[model samples]
Target: MMYTEENKKEVILFGYGKFGRHMYHHLSQGGHHVKLATMVESNYEEASADRIKDIKRFNPKHNDSIRMLGINPAKHLLYCAMEHTSNNLFLVLSLRELYHDAMIVAISNSEENTRKLKYAGADTVIDIYEASAQHLVTNLTKPAVAEAISTIFFEKNNLKIAEILLESDTLLEGKHAAEIDFYGRGLILVAVIDREMGDELIYLSRGVDHKFDAGDTLVLAGKADDILSFKMELAGV
Candidate 1:
């Protein structure tokens, strides 16, 4: 049940707040089925209506309403984006109690809350303020990289930057980029992070003759399907 950056997950967003909606959009755009749930309080019909309104504000064409906790709890990425950090922590605790292998991601409001969320068994805890500040810094320092990130996160297309690790016996280990014909494969090899060289990511502006090594990570930017094909080729499958 170890989740890696390469693993695509079906998400169940556990709130209808601003951050929850934001996560929903990103997950859906990333080709994941996302479901919404909210804590039931007071009148069930009223709470469901409120959640539906929040969803429609983002997706006007969406007519489906958020449901309660009837979702199959296992094998899903559970996102706890409740506006209240304490409530999110409680939800994480409850989810962990039910689904031991579920990947729970939570958002935190403060540094203390981030620690608390992690302690409460959230696999990943993100602080909105800190993430926003980091995005601002990247935009300021590395505009080109920031633009690439924005294209992946903000754009609705399937274009994205993906990383693939080469195994010792991979077919792509010692082949040059031109030998593999990246242009024909519908992708561009962006960079190579050499493991022997302290894992420094070297951008390949001219990698026709660049030889890949075992354990070297390939950074590519292209359509998601093309990236999958490249990974499969690397594995000689």
Candidate 2:
């Protein structure tokens, strides 16, 4: 996918590493200026050109690069490269003084880095390892849950995980989410049923005491076994 000049917001990528190239092309094809920066442009060659296009290069080590190019407001979305997994907080924070309202997406190889990035004021800190691992697990084991889950790029491995339908004879039928603790027992309850207005996913523990209807479903999380056990318990299996 390539952007042929039709998008609105200009996007700037902080590095030309693998993640940078992926983010650049993904955003570019979706329509953005997609200025890709790196210590050198040679890293982004024809071999990887298919994944990137019209990338503006810069030197990562040059202070002038940060002064002139690293923090430009011309771009609306700035995706920091995550593949390098180095001191990205400093690089990302340096841009804040330059582009105040720019939407910054920081990618980290670990949860610690992700937390650091968030602490440093990145718009969103994405966990690259978490995203990759989840995708691998879901794709390899349960391809059925790919779309039901939110994009790993945005979520911290805890999005709308799994959806389940409840039967009338379930033990957890007339239960409230707050009554049961899913904080560490594995899995969290995101929504429950109202049983009337067509899939009205009411937030758990917010004071909706409606009993479980036959067609009602309870969405939950954790491992596949936990999810299934939750469903069976609710379905009276």
Candidate 3:
């Protein structure tokens, strides 16, 4: 799905430890309404005496779009960044029991826990170590590309990378990637995930032609507005 400012998700983070704290800062700075959800609210004060001040402090580096939220079951997206994999799994399970439709993204520090987290009802499981190694590799081998990626991720801008799955009735079905003219529409078609090919996504830069099919997820990087518009166009919504 597209990730524009208007469509930015309201996320409830399940921990406030090192990883949780950093995630809170980054996502809030990125203009997402994020709330810290602990087993107890006082954990905030225990974790950081200046937690409230820090949360309320407006970073001059970021725009006024940064937002914070309280625990609300209505909030649809949950990010489980607990320090322990077991805790993360339990938290995901509990949240799943509460919000059946909630979109859960759980962080896994171990390979074994990754599958467990997914089976526990997390829609997506992120491996911290794997991601860190990938990031390090990118920085070491492709500094320029890494810098550009950092600008999109760390800095506040209209640019964003999003993955959108095409449904059976999508307007773009049956078309080739070259026929879509993504650049003309202000988007860079980065890759296409082929569902029928055992989850192997074809990157446009690989010099391979693709026939757009239903259930194929298109990964695109572009300005938030453009990305949202593209998603809408494909969905014919």
Largest TM-score belongs to which candidate? Answer: 3
lDDT of 3 by residue, 71-154 (tens): 345565788887767777877786677567778898898789998999999989989899999889999999999999887765
Task: Give the TM-score (vs. native) of candidate 2.
Answer: 0.52
Instruction: Give lDDT: candidate 2, residue 60.
Output: 40
Point out where model 1 deviates above 4 Å: 1-8, 40-74, 163-219, 223-225, 235-237
lDDT for predicted candidate 1 compared with the true structure: 0.71
- Model 3 quality (TM-score): 0.69
Per-residue error (Å), model 1, residue 16: 0.9
By descending TM-score, how would the candidates be arranged?
Answer: 3, 1, 2
lDDT of 1 at 112: 94
Order the candidates by lDDT, highest first.
Answer: 3, 1, 2
Which 10-residue window in model 2 sums to the lowest lDDT?
151-160
Better of 1 and 2 by lDDT: 1
Candidate 2, 1-237: lDDT as tens digits = 121233347767777667776776666556566676665446656325566554555554455766666455654577788356554666677666556777778988878888888877688887877988988898878876774554422343433256666666665556755566666557876787666767567876677655566667666656555665565666566
